[model samples]
Target: MAEPSITIRDNGPYVVTMPVEILDAKGNPLTITRERITLCRCGASNNKPFCDGTHNKINFESQVSA
Candidate 1:
């Protein structure tokens, strides 16, 4: 398997490309059926921990570089 990568988008959610196990607060595994997923960063999604395109609605702004 290739190493997983997490990419920070331009004012958007973090894009993850890899098979992963998502956990809840109690350490319970959250079901993820896809290798590619978008994680919420703007804290505006009705679906917590996942991106639901709410950032675009709220006009969220963030830019990070290495």
Candidate 2:
């Protein structure tokens, strides 16, 4: 099995490699149909928990490395 990976995009979302499950606050599962997923980080996406390019519109900035 391949290990999952996660990448943080510049001023954008968290790009996640799948075979993973995402649960809502209510513990309900969110449908994941893609090989990878883009999760919101800037808290501006109308589509909560997913990236809708709101970070670009809002000019969100972040510096992180690991």
Candidate 3:
């Protein structure tokens, strides 16, 4: 099995590529059907943890470097 890869997008969501599961507050797994997932960053997404392209409308700016 391959390891997961995560990328922080500029002014966007956290792009993740893995086979890991996303659990909720109750420890229940969220239903998702995609090879990759984009998580919210600006805390203004209607989808909560998921990215609904709300950052672009709010003009969120964040660039990560290591």
Candidate 4:
């Protein structure tokens, strides 16, 4: 396994790399299959944490630096 990395996108979700485990409020885990995943940051996703591309409509802004 590779060292996990998190990438903050420009006005978008936080891109996360696997193999990783994300826990819910009940201490359950989210089932992830993709090697890379996008998590919501704008707090607009119908599916919280995971992005549903709502930022584009709400005009959220944030720049990510390497």
lDDT for each of the candidates? 0.91, 0.88, 0.89, 0.90
> Which regions of candidate 3 fall more than 4 Å away from where they truly are?
none
Off by over 4 Å in 4: 64-66
Question: Candidate 4 on 3-55: residue-level lDDT in tens?
Answer: 78888999899989988799999999999888988999999999888998999
lDDT of 2 by residue, 1-66 (tens): 456888898878999998788899899999888888899999999998899988998999986788
Give the per-residue lDDT digits (tens) of candidate 1, residues 18-38.
777778999999888787899
Candidate achieving the largest lDDT: 1
The residue ranges of model 2 lying beyond 4 angstroms of the native Cα positions read none
For model 4, give the RMSD to the true fold. 1.7
For candidate 4, what is the TM-score?
0.86
What lDDT does candidate 1 reach at residue 58? Answer: 98
RMSD (CA, Å), each prediction: 1.3, 1.4, 1.5, 1.7
Model 3 over residues 3-66: C-alpha lDDT tens digits? 7788899889998886779899999998887878999988999998999999999999998888
Deviation in Å, model 1, residue 17 alpha carbon = 1.2
Candidate 3, lDDT over the whole model: 0.89
TM-scores of all predicted structures:
0.89, 0.89, 0.87, 0.86
